[model samples]
Target: MKPIFKRPRFGTTSTAFWAATIGLLLIIAAVAGWPNPVIFVMGAILLATGLLIWQEITAGLWIGLSVFGLLTVLHLTRAATYFQLRYLIYSLAFAQLGYECWRGLQRTRDGIDSEDIDDENGDGEEDKPMISLVLLQRQPKYLENMILTKVVESAWGGDYSNSDAQSDDDADDGDGFVVGESPMFVIKAPAGMFLVHNFDVPYWDNKDEVVEAIGELRLRNAVEEHTAWLSVDMLTPGDEEPDLNEAYLLVAKLLTALADEDTLAVVRPESLDLNVWSDDVVARLLTPGAYEELSLPDNAPVIPIADDAPEMRAAIATAQQRWPEFADAFQQRASHDKADDGPSFVVKAKITAGDSTEFIWVDVIGLEPKFVHGHLANDPVALGDLKLGSQVEFPIEDVCDWCYEKDDEPVGLFSLEAIRQIQEAQQTNEQ
Candidate 1:
């Protein structure tokens, strides 16, 4: 697991107390001519705290801290006789700590706090709720008006009364106004208010490796060629029961109005996952209680509603029809052309035993004349002894779907898409 780092919030009275305590300890160590283990232990603790909890430690800081720690330990163990040299090193470490504390105090006085710190890990504990969209084309003129109109017409109905609109002519005229760079608008809804804005820079500007590592192939491809992006952040604060349902609906409508074939991807940054979007995807988004369901942890498995639904059959047919494309892509993978493209390339196929049949993901390891060979990516519900990572082979005709990451983008996900479509249709029929 990756180590999670967080910035320390300074400028508190406790910070002032620690600063004074360290200063007193340093003074005691310098006057006594004795190796102050307390000071050394404190130094080590501070360095560790700075590294793991505070600001991102630089290479220079790391080296300095490491040397200080090593020397302190050596001095404590009575392995060194260089008492003067040890005192000098201790003084330098104290100076560094004092400087950092002073900097923190200065920042606090300027109203800058821990919130200014970049939460790179995206654990979402400290961040606000937000939805972001990236597209391959710039949005149309009067984007705010378009979004508001769509939101009002959606399943979760709401209206935005724009105070900026002057006269009837201004509201009706085609030559109303040109949207400036990074235009922001407030949307007043039944749930609460939302802030929508277009960003000047694309969100995925320098994060190519992140996208690739996460297996968001579609999102990766979109970012590579994206021209525009926007964010919708919930503005109304809530204690317990926030209007998350309406917020999702608002995003759904926004996507309905703005998203097209050119739209790249929709993302909830807090969740740190790329949402797959289709025309029918909006229907799923608008369903009651979907927000809570989607907000579940990423590790949870998504069980399909049915194994033999029409959408499943349709997905299998589509994958078979597009089998040539998968074969060609596989051939590319076999060659050095697509080396190290992703972690795994797998296909979903049907497995049967007794009275049970289930579709399972299988990692692609080799190819045969009439069969695709690989290990099972998922444990079977019915098949015994054969567990996850077990070698499995299936004929080409039984393959329902295939997915591989190439060029930092996902290539095929027919069955996954079909499952979503199936869920969307079912929800719609129920309504």
Candidate 2:
């Protein structure tokens, strides 16, 4: 497999640690005239770590370290009486690595200059925004609250001097400060939106309103002129895009329109990328061939029936106890579906067993895939899941198998809240 690890981004925390570790080794090699083999090994490490840093300041460090270590190795090994000759090659390698690192940073940074075109949906000739978008699907409100607090605190406490120097440099370059005081924007759509917001907001409340309104608007689209009920069926092959997905595309189209009209700030989350979970729940539920099912929340607000719906409450609790993964996915999915209108491009999955192979659909349903409304499947069906299909296997196994064999259905998923209620219900039933 191509490397799973992301090469280090310069200016990140990890780069510092790597520098320090390499620094200590170099010092030992320099001071004690360590063995030739040990010295060469240290130099090799320096070369590798420098490349991984992906930035001039840090990458140069590795080159320097490598050259120093290499020279020390040559001296200790006594390869030649004329150390001067050997120094020439090591010096050349050092210069080459340094020049490459510096030029590479400029080239890469230059590509990202398209940040000036805020009106485009990050589709310009330049690199996609230096900004990374993350999705926090079907996350619990309690957990969100805790994490959000940290984000706000980090923003407030972060150093601004470097930011100021950078801004000045951008201005001097004629790019004219590609970004302002807020390098990041924070907005929340209770459900989710497929479109990333890109405008200035005076307060968090306004941002929240704009996001929530988008979700409300998209939900309106799903319903007909006069109907509380929504009709969803087997997705035709050509109907690759779901209703929410279409809503998101419309959102992108609208945002693109706005960008064309004005100089927007490009409202986007600071940490909305996905690093984990539920890649197959969508296919298992929607595809007929897959034979899995679930009742969607369908863009409705969760009217916290905290004291009312005894069954839902019980189900949440019981599922949490018996199937933590299911309960988590259920609650997360509920939040995701109810919170936004943007399409969360969920993945479609297919699984094959002894005899037949089946297709299933899975995805972040509401607008934005990130935020509260994410989940894996945990439907609690009748027959147990045979766990067939090699394709169905994923790093994230949030789905719970209830029925298999004759039932021949896929597993169900749930967010944490749903599992909590399910857990309670199971306890009640057992008692």
Candidate 3:
């Protein structure tokens, strides 16, 4: 048997019809001069009060009472001619007010709460799949007319919003984003569809500058991260798993080009799903020198993932699938095989001498005066650059700690995790 469907009592069409009828009456009353425009406007307002119980009980009640009081006073004091012309209009408003009061009370007695109205009408629908992106130290100039645009254009499917207003050159300008400005855009690709929008970083000193790039990916999901890493937010259609193959191809094309330019980046999805990322794309990013601290600007921080983090493991495993060279390099670095003669307690430290601190990690070999004895970490791209892996000594008070490698004992300035693990182990042993 076919299912029976009931018509909604207050659907859009019925509401529109009533609203239109009242509006037409207001226009006719103005022409005939039967009632003042104020009376007809009050009548229209009463209709709104009848539709919304909360409004009728709240502000609407006071408005209705005031209008009636004013009209009654005017009727008693005014001449016969004045009362006769406006009587019909005033009566219509009064009848509307009475109907609103009656309906509002009836709805309240029936236990129909205002909040449930939207649920009954299915007004709050689920959003489409989406993801967000954030880019730091952004160079919009690099994205202009580059191979990156070509890849995105090649996958150009179409967009929901106007695309004619935007061009690669237009997006390249710093005017696209100003301090406190968040612009939104939509781009379609054969691989997937998504939106791009900006968010403010209030804590950042350059809040007003358009130097940084931050964006969202509608139809894809994003996860929060401590470090400045590019998030892989590929979009997908509803009720469908993401097409990993297409996403991988797109990422490979984009990241490979980025790496060729020696761009130091750390990109991850808002949420990590191994099935959504192919092996090639992961290897391209995690490849040893692809995004090493040494390759970045002096003192530029690394991605901040712990040695044993799942993301690092995933990258390593993905690298093993297609890029053995990157896999080997990633494993070596993840193992912490950097050259240093200092004790395990002496973690990597950055020197803060002046306006710009030294950009390389130093080996703290001595205490008392706090001496650093080592060359700056070598940058693969610019090997042996000046000040890199250079030996320098500073007061113990002058060094700023960036990160701590895993180590045992109450070594100098170890990470909180290392300290907590040691205390737990010691407690268990005593027990």
Provide C-alpha RMSD values for all models, in order.
22.6, 24.3, 19.6
Tens-digit lDDT string for candidate 3 (150-202): 43444332222222223334434321211101122233444554333222222
What stretches of model 2 exceed 4 Å from their correct place? 1-40, 43-98, 102-272, 275-431
Output the worst ten-in-a-row residue range by lDDT, candidate 1. 173-182
lDDT of 1 by residue, 1-431 (tens): 22343324532222333343344434444444367777765555544444432343333234434544555565444323443332333444445444545555465567665555443453222344444333333332235555544444453443333333444344343322212122455454555545555544455556566545443333344455555666665543312234566666666565556556656555666565454444334555567546444323222243545656888788889888988888877777678654455457789887766676667899888877799898888656446667678898888888989887767888889877877887688679979
Q: Kindly give the number of clashing pairs for every candidate.
A: 2, 78, 22
lDDT of 2 by residue, 1-431 (tens): 21424433322222323344444445445544445666556655664554445343445554544554554555534423443322333344344444434544554466533233332333322222222222222211122223332332342232222212222233233211111111122222222211122212221334344444332222222111111111111111111233433333323222222222112122223222111112242332223322111222222222222334565445434433454443344456456664354323232222334554332334433322222222323221111353212123432222222211113433333233553575577569979
Q: Estimate the lDDT of model 2.
A: 0.32
Candidate 3, run of 10 with poorest lDDT: 216-225
Give candidate 1 misplaced runs (Cα > 4 Å): 1-161, 165-182, 214-216, 238-241, 292-431
Most accurate candidate by lDDT: 1
Order by lDDT, highest first: 1, 3, 2
Candidate closest to the true structure, highest TM-score: 1
